[model samples]
Target: MDIDKLSIKKKRVMIYFIEAARRLMASEGVRALSIRGIAEIAGYNSATLYNYFDDLQHLTLFASMSYLRDYVSALSGNLKPPMSSLQRYRVIYETFDHFAFRSPEIFYNMFFGRQSAKLPEVVVQYYALFPEELKEHFPSVRKMLTQGDMYRRDEPIVEELVRDGFVRPENASPLSAVVPRLNQTYLHELVNGKDISPEEQHRRFIAVFDYLLETAK
Candidate 1:
């Protein structure tokens, strides 16, 4: 559908629904987001949301993508280049961690709201929402994941390391298997409501993530 052809009032209603969903996620967590709840908050009837979104998950995921835009926005004017692949890799996580800490609710919703840790279809849809300027903050491997299937999701990063001479060709499979585990650990810790300081969080992240990098060599 050409959303551009949508009437201004219709566009405004869609925005209201999406924003209402976001407000709910921020205040009451992802589980609180229901079509009726959103409609109530947005001053619309329950059935009205169907005109804007296909289902509750569609609106919820759409709302979640705004947090990603915020994450990308936070990285604006922040990345310093001339770093190694490993360094760039660290920056990516650091940038994400910083944003996640600052906006715990949204990041938790984005990373841990779904039952399956991976949101392949939603991730693919959200990637298209990123503006061109923020596109550079995305790692090459992330681009690969969004474009391709999630099986062997870490393969591209390992291949990049091999291309950079950071990992030997033969060690690719082992390294790929282990490197993504660090992310799993980090996300698990972040959403589990662990009572750790931001400093401590970074410390733990560096310890495990750096160890993975070391083992990759």
Candidate 2:
């Protein structure tokens, strides 16, 4: 549903559910989320949640995006002027690595989980419902955030590198394809692994990401 077209009361109800899910996620973490738990916290029954959301994963995705506020806010500071495309790309991913590693399961579910395909619509719906999170970013950064598909989001960056001669034209496609997958692999490990700290995970991801960039050049 187009969130803007929803009746005011319906939007309010949806916000209640989304905010409730966010509180649950913040307090107990992603894996602990349950429809009944969210509904109870929102002061509604589980069936009412279905009226506002497609399913548990749908609601979860909406709730998960609150975690990205830090990432979007930090990106503007890292992406200053007088930087090469390669440098800008590094800064963007490094900033992402810092935050994503902190909440691997949330990031993983948002981008790679079963409901991943609905991400584009969910992003539009999410920001429409909570425009404040979308407001702090610069125009370009905001564009990046709204790009729901991870591969499509990174393509333009790789294309810019190719245009600037930092990356070979022939290498652009492969780099774009491989980079997200590599990030996904590491993210999967971080989400499921028992002992690794976020700091270590970030370092390891950057090492591999930097190595891939070097080889792509």
Candidate 3:
């Protein structure tokens, strides 16, 4: 009967619905989701779901945002806070490794599922939610000024690397943008029906991830 108790219950219910939405999206795609489907998944009546979320689109975005938040956190993984820019780079790769290793399905969906994810707002928001595509990596080139990390000091050299096209901006998704194709082709060839070990898949993905990072570094 207490208002606080009621609020807590509502929050818990919303969390349930968010998770349900993700599974439903992955299994059936966003087009198949409806109030009835989500309600069934959440073990609630259709009208009950409306109490916590405005509508199906709102619910879809909430679920997508939750996934994105978790992803950003994962990118930081086990690193101490206040990571150096180079360390930050490692964290990003570490996040890539974690996702590639543990939940490639969700990781695959995060990018490939965008068209089917069905929340235009969520899609638009997440296009930029992509951290590697962010412009922040340009300034980070300065981190090379540090003695032994990724970058090197000499201004003319850095400039020549930049000028001769050796250095690509970090925001550039030279490899990432093509991941859908790579997955369709390379990764599928390696896995799909094969009895590939998880370690092998992890190694393959890390190798690809490292290859992309090598140029930017």
Listing every candidate in turn, what is its Cα RMSD in Å to the true structure after a full C-alpha superposition? 5.3, 2.3, 11.3
Ranked candidates (TM-score, high to low): 2, 1, 3
Compose the digit string of candidate 1's lDDT tens values, residues 1-217: 3455777788778778877998988888876788889999999999999886667766776687655655555543354567776666667677777776655555655555552244455554444433352365556434534554233345765677788988778888877776556665665675667788766787787788777777767
Which predicted model would earn the best TM-score?
A: 2
Best by lDDT: 2
lDDT for each residue of candidate 3 in 54-121, tens digit (9 for 90 to 100): 67766666555545445544443445666554444445555544554344444444444443333334
Model 3 stretches with alpha carbons more than 4 Å out: 1-16, 19-37, 41-61, 64-67, 77-87, 115-194, 211-217
Enumerate clash totals for all models, in the order shown.
Answer: 0, 0, 1
Task: Indicate the worst ten consecutive residues by lDDT in candidate 3.
Answer: 144-153
Q: After superposition, how far is residue 77 of candidate 3 from its true place, in Å?
A: 4.5
Q: What is the lDDT of residue 174 in candidate 2?
A: 93
Better of 2 and 3 by TM-score: 2
What's the true lDDT of residue 11 in model 1? 70
Worst 10 residues of 2 by lDDT: 144-153
In candidate 1, which residue pairs clash?
none
